[model samples]
Target: FGKNFLITTHYASLPWLDSLLQEAQEKSAEEHLMSRGIAFLLYTFLDTLVDSYFPVLDDIDEIIDDLEDVTVNSTSNDVQVRIFRIKRSLAQMRRVISPQVEVVNALVARTGKFIPAKMNPYFADVHDHLIRAFEVLDSYRDLMGGMLDVYLTTVSNRLNAVMKQLTIIATVFMPITFITGVFGQNFGHLPQVEHDNGYLFWIVLAFMGLITALQLWYFKKRGWL
Candidate 1:
């Protein structure tokens, strides 16, 4: 383009540019872009590139929606992994695209040999698309952050629930444990140890059962169960 001739090369296939090139080639003969010069073609190329990002953003939107629905019930590590991965992807996209937004805006503002004054509206349109992309990306970043918070909160709540259950079990066994400890003593004067008919054993068992039932009933009444 600097030598008044458009030279192009690609080490990797760019599907977006490929389609754009195809269309441009088909229009070259009829549209006579050669008469308007390479500036027009450059604008079209950049415009196509900018337009490709929308489809990707749309797909990200769908993924975010799905994640939000699953985030409430999902406790798997996969959800966290996906959230981080998408966040990194969005960050990379923002880094790469942000400068391009400015560049397009600059192109609209500055008229040069390659960028004509008459094409400001075209470049401005590209700028608008870039701004829209930025808005979507920023919103997705916020959503990803929110999803991460929700996942952590869910995990914390589950942990608290487990701890509560364990604590309740311990509480229910506390008096029973004390009763057994008292009977387990080696002292001969311990109640029920001097019994010859083994009636004391049944009494101790009944007492323990009674304590357990009472504790459970209290817990149920308090809505702790």
Candidate 2:
């Protein structure tokens, strides 16, 4: 197994793992990691695996930025979908990275003949890289949680705005609805009952228009719109 590299995984659909291996191979070509011995090669592979997390996390950070923008300007259902999607992605990353902490620690703890003394320090360095990956993953998880909270709050505020708008519209029309209802009555003793198309009707219409304009102006000045 000295010169042979075995690539085995149950997940054939994992393009990320393949990509990491490919990238590590490219870097190794430039730096010649093969001369660093077997244990060093192991460290290099693990370090590459850990380093791949950073670019993925960067992409996730970009998504969080987009989600935050959506939270402020819009409350579409897609925001909720994206929030959950980010959380799930973070969870998956943790699943992959967390156990590697233990794996790297075990590798550093080994004192067998297979692991040369000179490579112990290299394994320790890889262990540190795994620790940093775990820390960053946790940070990303917390960030995703905070974004979820902001998204929920934004949705709630949007709902309240819609309700408030409906309330305002109903309140502005209440008096006009009452006046019209009364004037539409079939009673014989009503004052404006016979004046269907006369001065009283025009006066009521002007009064309603004035009240509507005043309400709209008041709402605008209050910055409710």
Candidate 3:
């Protein structure tokens, strides 16, 4: 008997992957499969599939790791959008692998035809690898959820800081506004109104200074400044 390999995938853009597959195909020795040709061929095929996932998983892990820095440092909304896009890509990969797993299981169950009794273990190994791949994807999904939470928290903190600063500015101006308003009013019979009083200016300056000092102290004490 002879073994023929046919690989069908949606990954048309990766030239290196195509080259790797082509090289493997050309370098594969039929002499190595002289005895258990069918079984080992299936093993080779499934092993390739299983091994391919590790590098992809590694790349995904690296990107996920970088997301923490991106969440903290990036000011552009594109980072969030890129995260969603990566998630969608991961979902697509998961979708593809799930069906492949089902297919492998079905092949394993219908063991009479293409896959013989001797090859069951090899197919089971494929199924195990597929399961591991899915588990990794599950972990990545959880990680994506965590990254989103971190992003939201960082954004909320920045917003709160801005609001706190604005509030402090408004608070500082409040007493100064009160002083200006009192001095601006036309109370003709008031005690300090008759003289061109520098004392009135002194009083206003003192009130403004006292208010500013008090606010600074309160803000410092509250650690909100």
Global lDDT of each candidate: 0.86, 0.77, 0.78
Q: Where is the poorest 10-residue window by lDDT in model 3? A: 1-10
Residues 137-188 of candidate 2: C-alpha lDDT, one tens digit per residue: 7887898788778878888987998999999989899988988898888787
Best by lDDT: 1
Better of 1 and 3 by lDDT: 1
Pitting candidate 2 against candidate 3, the one with the higher TM-score is 3
Task: Please report, as a residue range, the 10-residue window in candidate 2 with the lowest summed lDDT.
Answer: 1-10
Runs with alpha carbons beyond 4 Å of true place in candidate 2: 1-10, 13-37, 195-197, 213-225
Give the number of the best model, judged by TM-score: 1
User: Using Cα atoms with residue i matched to residue i, what is each candidate's TM-score against the true structure?
Assistant: 0.92, 0.75, 0.83
Residue 135 of model 1, lDDT score: 91
For model 2, what is the C-alpha lDDT against the true structure? 0.77
Q: Model 3's lDDT to the true fold? A: 0.78
Assess candidate 2 and give its TM-score to the true structure.
0.75
Tell me, what's the RMSD of every candidate?
1.9, 4.4, 3.2
